[model samples]
Target: MKHREYGVVQRVDHHGRTAIVNWYRTYTSTDEPVPQLLYESEMSVYDLKDHPDFQYRPGTVVIRVANFTGEDANCTAGQ
Candidate 1:
């Protein structure tokens, strides 16, 4: 039940408290194809601005990829 993060940015939705980012899974250990649609939840635009994993550049798209296992499922389950 682990959620693995990945690369690729396609769209950004900021209607709710968290920013909904649409991205693709370009890499995976499984035999599935790459560039698949991946889900990102509970991400805020403000948080992305100060995230250490990625830098928010001017006019540049910022994405935060996180992996949440069953133990960490609470962090990204309802969004």
Candidate 2:
């Protein structure tokens, strides 16, 4: 499923050409009466424009709000 989410670039590794992205999610659950948000961080090798969640030009520090797959938003490191 697709959901609206946001990702912020937290750190970049020039040598590895990778960036650490902090992702945020806001959603309303059937069991909950109010909206809730979640936060997660991940590393990616794709450029900002090529990233699945970050397809726009990013500044030194960046934040992009876009539609993301449920798998992408719920993914956690180390399974």
Index of the highest-TM-score prediction: 2
Q: State the lDDT at 22 in candidate 2.
A: 64
Q: All predictions: root-mean-square deviation over Cα? A: 14.3, 12.9
The residue-by-residue lDDT of candidate 2 on 8-32, one tens digit each, is: 6778888888878766565655443
Point out the worst 10-residue segment of candidate 2 by lDDT.
59-68
Tens digit of per-residue lDDT, candidate 1, span 44-68: 6566443245455559864434544
TM-score of each: 0.29, 0.39
Weakest 10 consecutive residues of candidate 1 by summed lDDT = 1-10
Count of clashing residue pairs in every prediction? 0, 0
What lDDT score belongs to each candidate, Candidate 1 first?
A: 0.50, 0.56
Q: Which residue pairs does candidate 1 place in steric collision?
A: none
Show model 1 residue runs off by greater than 4 Å: 1-4, 7-17, 28-33, 49-79
Best by lDDT: 2
For model 2, the superposed segments whose C-alpha errors exceed 4 Å read 27-37, 50-79
